[model samples]
Target: MNNNLPEKQPPEKTDWLLFPQEISRDDIEKEIKKTPIAIQKILNYYLLTDFESKYEEIHLFLKHFNENKKIPIAKINNPVIYKIIKTARSIQRQIHKLMGLLRFREIEGGYLYASFTSDFNIIGPLSLHFSRRFPEEKLIIHDTKRRKALFVEKGKLYEVVSLNTLPSDTDEESFFRQLWQRYHQNISITERENKKLQRQNIPLKFQHWLTEFKGSCALPQLDGNRENI
Candidate 1:
């Protein structure tokens, strides 16, 4: 006779709630259904992104709503409401920035690869913009800080934890990168250079992956192995 132990399952979000040990997803869903349709849409769309502080904010909001079945309207006056709004806006801003700043390099397999680190998890939102912009192309937007990626092919999108390894840039990509750098340099006037404004617009942290700043299209190395989410 042989005995094998069952595989362990990861902890669920409800299992970690401190005050209300018996709270469940069903309870949250019921409470969410009671809110106005517009408020429900805002909560469902913006608040549920992969933000690190989301769970805590969600828990607090749910707890408050359970006691008083109302969504806070005055966000500026209410600290909790303000914090949640701020977090969502931060993610939105990052998405906007990445959409504009992301420079994709065509690699050996004719795939566009772009890698950048974002303070907030904005890959999911970014994928929608890029997929629409390049409908037929295969694109990978890697979030180096979070070790996550959004893969888009033929207008379809999916996520991967870590990419296998990015191939080197194609000859055309190299030529264009050099040409862009030269153009960027020529356009700059030393008398008109504004370090403070440049820093504010494109923070120093993001310069590494920007082709014009680095003078070349470079792929960043992925960290150690990561399990798919």
Candidate 2:
């Protein structure tokens, strides 16, 4: 902690560049210069995706970007360029979906915690998002598969050294959690239930951690030619 820091408050926005320290984006832009929006999206994909041979792919993409800044990216047919572009698009979709789907709960010390697992390494972008979205509120967004967490406090973000599993939510959390769960159940039109399509919109992989699906054993299941709930 540097006591020489300014007394001003941090900004209420996040970006592609993540500084582990309390450095502001303005300070970073002074050093690295502001990256273009197109390049920033590519950087987000580079940071989020863990595809094999990624080092080679990114090196190729950056080389191409430098040489052909004026041409449309879709016209690039190099193998590495095409693969990275596709992977970037996949990462973009995962980030968009997971941001909307994460469900936070009030935990000990009044911290809000949300946990989920994903095939891609996506915790960084999600933390950047929620930190801005809930600046005053403390938050912990955990990526279960990675066994890591993003800790945010007072609108400043912290990348933790290590984290054991958090204790259960505050006792008071149960009441509101149940209320929301019940409300979700009550408004449903079971007569029009379509498990197949429902799963299409909200994949079963994400349902296990969602509150509304809790304690409900009738979740859709399939067995070849037979469907079971």
Candidate 3:
């Protein structure tokens, strides 16, 4: 007797709601339908060239999916597509904000050490910022979220092992951060503060980045005062 596991189905396609508002569901479907088969051929060639050594069947399946499925262009009208696009855009914005707010510190041996979560692909914009801000210092931005890092040494950028490999963890930079936080905290006045202006100054999503944001850090060491909490 032979027992075989049931075949697993492909995961559902991503929703289009998350996509840019300009790209509609009908537009997407229409584009897909109108595109020549040559596009798939080109895609197959590139995929096989890139990934065939590890997964030969990947190209075959992609080709098959391309031929078999009807991907509508205007996925914007589709609720599922809309949701996917919307979520993707939100994630992109968060990553962009994080990169913009990333603080870089110069370390020993001309090495600049900066760290952040790498949930989204924020490295590209980050490199742009560092190139503009610090033309002299070679740097690395270790993104803990994805356990990956980018090294910008002598103006060249490349991916490297995570900074978790570094000798010190958060302990390495916690002291300076605490001092900086204290200085900022001390200057704030409760009497003249405008809650609306505060919200406008720092959006709720990015409040996690603010040292004054209550309960941001779970650890007592990183957590600030709890007057509001």
Candidate 4:
């Protein structure tokens, strides 16, 4: 046989490029406004959706969006559309869960302090719900995972980051916690204890911060002898 080398195959072409660009918050807000109302809601929700690969997912969505001027929903089989829908659903679920599961305790300054780590950046969305409900009360919804907090005071809402500290709980808080735990235990029906169903509804991740959960009453306690402000 004649010694002959096989021809080298050309490199496979990619449909996407990897150029990194600096995008400002205002610019992004402006771009979001240019989209249809329905699409704008999706884009806003995507901002609060938390995922490890969110940046890549959003980049892909933007690429598709820029080309089509709208999501190609007719192509339901498209991976980008599927991902966007999945992310939006996840964010919605977390928001609903927190609306019920989030527990706030009264602190020294008549402030309601609730601490929880959410899979999504939900504090911003939760602020509106809580502000409407507890309009007059000062509230702090702290996101332990992101080290950020949403402060709702005097009918205004704002966010602060890298603030991991919390003030001491008031004596009334401790007393109420005991009563709450007792009420929870007294109302339980041992026969109807469906651990699987409970986990399905409340989820184990959320249970750790819920007031009705066994050890959660002890949470949100002051860290390192911090004096109450």
Candidate lDDT (C-alpha), each: 0.72, 0.73, 0.53, 0.76
Q: Rank the candidates by lDDT, best first.
A: 4, 2, 1, 3
Measured against the true structure, the TM-scores of the candidates, in listed sequence, are: 0.73, 0.73, 0.48, 0.77
Q: Write the per-residue lDDT of candidate 3 for residues 56-148, one digit (tens) a residue.
A: 232223334455457642222444334333444555565557666666655555566777654454565677568666766788877665676
Best by lDDT: 4
Residue 85 lDDT in candidate 2: 74
Model 4 segments more than 4 A misplaced:
1-15, 20-25, 50-59, 62-76, 161-164, 216-229
TM-score of 4: 0.77
Error of 3 at 172 (Å): 14
- Top candidate, metric TM-score: 4
**Cα lDDT of model 1 by residue, 63-168, tens digit:** 5555555545543344665666666666667778878999899999878999998776667778889999999999988988778889899999988766878889
| Model 3 stretches astray by more than 4 angstroms | 1-75, 165-179, 192-229
Instruction: At residue 186, give the lDDT of candidate 2.
Output: 88
Superposition-based RMSD of candidate 3 using all C-alpha atoms, in angstroms: 12.7
Lowest summed lDDT over 10 consecutive residues: which window, candidate 1?
220-229
Global fold similarity of model 3 (TM-score): 0.48
